[model samples]
Target: MLVFVTGGVRSGKSDFAERRAISLLKENGSNLHYIATNQVYDKEMQERVKRHQQTREKSGANWIVWEQPRKIDELFSHFKKDDVLLLDCVTTLVSNELFSGWETNSEKWKNVVFQFEIEQNLKCLFSQLAGAPWHVVIVSNEVSYDGFASDEGTKVYKRLLGRLHQHIVLLAKEAIMVECGLPCWKKGGIRT
Candidate 1:
């Protein structure tokens, strides 16, 4: 099963997804896996990562954490049937994959090839997850409402993220948007 969760920053989407993953794990007697896509580059990010770690630790679930910021498909072989896997967020994954080789000011930012490549990579990863027997929960940020940034790079990032979110929601069995720590279901029922 593929589930999609999205919300603005500090909107509790990650916490919701983590709870869902743990529930699925307990229900199916499966392994809990956390694929953290955030690349901690500073003190703020480091603290955020620490908090997430602390939360999972307090949950009493043995979560196998994979700090994968790019090339998520590489971890496919490590997962097993019926396991619950939660991908913390897609926004950082896309940013990491998109800017890995190109500078923000480079003309390549305008090229459609980079976007296409990212879309293809994510598609491949999702396809593999769907084919497997595992349950996957994908979390992403809803950045479209963030006031318009006039920069070309920011524009391209937003466009790509929007497209990815649409594609993910379409493939997901359940789609949810978290606002003020409340989950609003956009697709599927509220599974107990």
Candidate 2:
């Protein structure tokens, strides 16, 4: 099953997805693999990464963590049909691609090449999940209502992210938008 969990910053989306994944694994006696997509590039990010790592460590030892800030498709070689893989986000990966200039000159979109790169990467990832046997949970920020970004770069980033959300939500078996610890289903039925 492919589950996409999304919310504004600090809206408990990750917690909710992690709990759901744990329940699924416990019921099926399967392994949990956390594919972390964030990198500690600065003090703030470092602290945030540390805090998240601590939380994961306390959560339990049944999980095997893989820190893949980019190139997530590479991990498919190691995953099994019975495993549960939770990818902590599409946002970070997109940001990385943008800053790294992967979208500067692509034919898919008139915008930056990284824009197409990010979208293509996400589409490929979700497409793989559509055919994979393992359960996949994806966590991402709900940037829709964050207000218009002030600069050109910000505006472009928002456009790409919004498009990415739409693309993934279409492929998601279950799509949720969370707020204040509550989840509102955007599409698909909840798993029984």
Candidate 3:
């Protein structure tokens, strides 16, 4: 089953998803895999990553962690069908791809190559997940409220993330939006 979880920044979406994953792992009797998609770019980010790692370690689950900051679609060869993979935060993965593709371009909206890269990479990862016979949980940020981006690159990134969310939500068996540490189920029930 595919589950999609989204919420504002630091809105407890990751914690909710991890708890659901723990229950699913216990019920399904499957191996737990945490696919961390974030990377530390500075000292502050390094500390944040350290804290997250510590939290995961203290969660009292035997989670096999994989750090895949990019090319997530190519990681299917590393696990089995019975593995329960929880990919925490698609926002960082998409941002990393956006930066990598946008760095070589001039105008953000007019860059066809960057657009193609983002579309292809996201689609590749989603399709790979679709074919995998495992319980998958995807976490993303919901930041498209005001519908206004200050810059062209931010605009492009927001639009890309919105589209990615729509696609994944459709592919998911369950969709949830976390607000202030509470989850409002949008598609399926909260039960595992």
| Clash count, predicted structure 2 | 6
Which stretches of model 2 miss by more than 4 angstroms?
101-114, 189-192
Q: TM-score for all predictions?
A: 0.93, 0.86, 0.90
79-149 per-residue lDDT for model 1 (tens digits): 88899999988999888877776544555546688678777887777777766799999999988879997
Question: Cα deviation in Å at residue 183, candidate 1?
Answer: 0.8
Model 1: which residue pairs collide? none
**Position 20, candidate 3: lDDT:** 82
Clash count, predicted structure 1: 0
> Top lDDT: which candidate number?
1
Residue pairs in collision within model 3:
none
TM-score of candidate 2 on Cα atoms, chains taken together: 0.86
lDDT by residue for model 2 over 1-192, one digit each (tens)?
888899999998988888767876876637899999887768998887787777778878477889998888889989887788888888887776665644465333335665776677778877887678888888999776788788777677788888887877877888988888887887775532
True-vs-predicted CA distance for residue 21, candidate 2, Å: 1.3
Local distance difference test, per candidate? 0.87, 0.80, 0.84
Q: How high is the lDDT of residue 127 in model 3?
A: 64
Per-residue lDDT tens digits for candidate 3, residues 1-192, read 888989998889988898888878887847899998888779988987787788788899998998888888777887787788999879998887777644466354458786777877797688678668888999999879656888977888888888889999888888999989998999988542
Point to the candidate with the largest TM-score.
Answer: 1
Against the hidden true structure, what lDDT does model 1 obtain?
0.87
